[model samples]
Target: MGGLATAMLGCPGMPELPEVETIRRSLLSRLEGRRLVAVAASGSPLRQPIQEAAWQACVGARLEDLTRRGKYLIGHLGRHAAVFHLGMSGRLLVQPASSPAPAHTHLTLGFSDGLELRLVDPRRFGVAVVMPAEEVSLYPPLARLGVDPLEGDVEAALASLAGTRAPIRNALLDQSVVAGLGNIYANEALARAGIRPTTPAGRLSPARRARLARATRDTLADALAAGGTTLADGGFVDGDGNGGYFAVALRVYGREGQPCQECGAAIRRAVMAGRSAFYCPRCQR
Candidate 1:
C-alpha cells in the first residue's frame, strides 16, 4: 500500500552469516525483557496476518533465550517462541513504543519498558511464526536448514559439497547444502579460494576446498567485525542506524565495473538463479 510496503514485497538484500549474527546480537540485548503486548497486520493475507490477539496472549512473557538457526532468529519466551525470517527485505527495529509505527510495520511487540520491537517488511514476505518453545528446533524451516557457516565446520562443508556437480557457487547458496551463505560471501569465498564460480562442485582440489573453507570463515569473520553490507538503496540498519559490517568491507559483491581489490582485474557480474553474482575473473579463476 505504501512505498515501505512495496519495498517489503521486493527481495531484501541477501543476508549472510554475519548479518544474521548482527541481528541476533542486537535483538538479544534489546528484546530480552521486552513483552509482546500487541501485534498488528496490514496489507497481509488474512491467513498469515500478524494476529494482534495471538501476540497479546504472550504479554508479560520474558524472552528466555535467543538463538540463530541458519538465517532465522528464534526468541524463546517461556512456553512460546517467536520465529522470524528476515526474508529479502525484512527488518527488525527497536524503538520507543511512542514512536509512530512506520507504514510497513506489519508486526509490533510492545514491551513493558515503553519500547517496541517492530517487524518492518516492505515486501510482506517476511514471516513471524509462533509456536511452542520446546518444539522450535523441529519447525520445518529451522529443521531443514543445514549447518550455519558461523558455527559449522569447514571439513563438513567441503564433505557436503564433495560429490556435487552443481557449480560450486550454487552449492554454497543451497540452504540444505550449507546454511547461511548468500551471494556476497559465496563470491568472496570463491575469489579468496582462487576457484571459479563456474567450477564444478566435485572438481575442487583438496587444497582449493580447504582454501575456500578458510575463505568462507575468514570473510564471515571480517564481515562480523565490520557490521554487514549496505547495498545501494538497501537500507539495512542496526538499532543505532549504523551500516552492516560486511557492507563496509565488501570486496567483490556489488563492485561490478570496479577493479578487483586483489588482482587489479575488473570485477564482473552475472545472473545466477535470477540474482546477481559478483566476482573477479582474474582472482576467482
Candidate 2:
C-alpha cells in the first residue's frame, strides 16, 4: 500500500482550489436554472460576517452560474450572486426539501424544484452572502489575490517566483503569489516540480522555475481530472456528498518514510510555516 506515490494524505482541514472547483462543477447542475424560493440565515455568522438581510437579496433570483476563484464559490443570478468561502470544515450539500437539515447548518437556499442547498460548517469558517453580481470582482479578498495559477499570468507568476526568498513551498502557498494553493497542494506541486520543498524560491534556476510553473498546472489538472483529493476526517467532498479519489494519486504529499516513486529514497517530512511538507529527498532538488 505504501509503495504507491499517490497515497491518501491524512491531513484534513481547509480545502484547496481543486476541491472547491470540483464543488463548483458539481453544484452547477443543481443550482443553475433553479429559482431561489427562499433564503434563510440560521445559526452564527461564518468567516465573513453573514448578513441575514443581504441573503434576502438572492430570494426570487435564479442561480444562473456557479463559478470559482481560488477557494471561493460564486453563485450567479443575472444581476446578483452569492459569494461562498468554505473555510475549514464547510460542506455545501444539496438535499431534498423534506430532508432534515444537518446540525451547524448556517445558511439554507431553497430552490423551486423542492431541493435545498445548505452550508454546514462545524468550525463556522465558511461564508455565504448574496450581493450584486459584479461586486465579486471588487470584493477585497478575490481582488487582492494573485495569479489564478491554472489560467492566470505565467510571466507574472515567474516574476514573483524570481523575487521571493521564501521557501518554495511557502511561496506557492501564498495566495498573493499564486492563488488557490494550500499546504497539501503546495507540497504536491513542489514534488511534481522535482524541487525541494524547502528550497529558496528566488534561487531556482530558470529551468526549475519553468518546471515549477508547469508542474503546478499539471498537478492541479491531474487532481481536477480525478475529482480532487479527499483526506482523512473528510474535510473535502464533491457537492453530491462523495469524496474525491485524487488522494491516492498523490506523488509525495503525506508519504513520510515511504519509498519515493522516482527514486528509492524514503520520502521526508518537515514543518514549514506551521504546515506539513512531504517530499522525496532524492527525487526533489
> What TM-score, computed on C-alpha atoms, does each candidate reach?
0.90, 0.93
Which segments of model 2 are wrong by more than 4 Å? Answer: 1-11
Number of the top candidate by TM-score?
2
Tens digit of per-residue lDDT, candidate 1, span 253-283: 7688999887788888877655567788887
RMSD of each: 3.4, 4.7
Local lDDT at 262 for model 1: 79
Each candidate's clash count: 14, 3
After the best TM-score superposition of candidate 1, give how far the Cα of residue 62 lies from its true spot, in angstroms: 0.5
- lDDT of every model, 2 decimals: 0.75, 0.82
The lDDT leader among the candidates is 2
TM-score of 1: 0.90
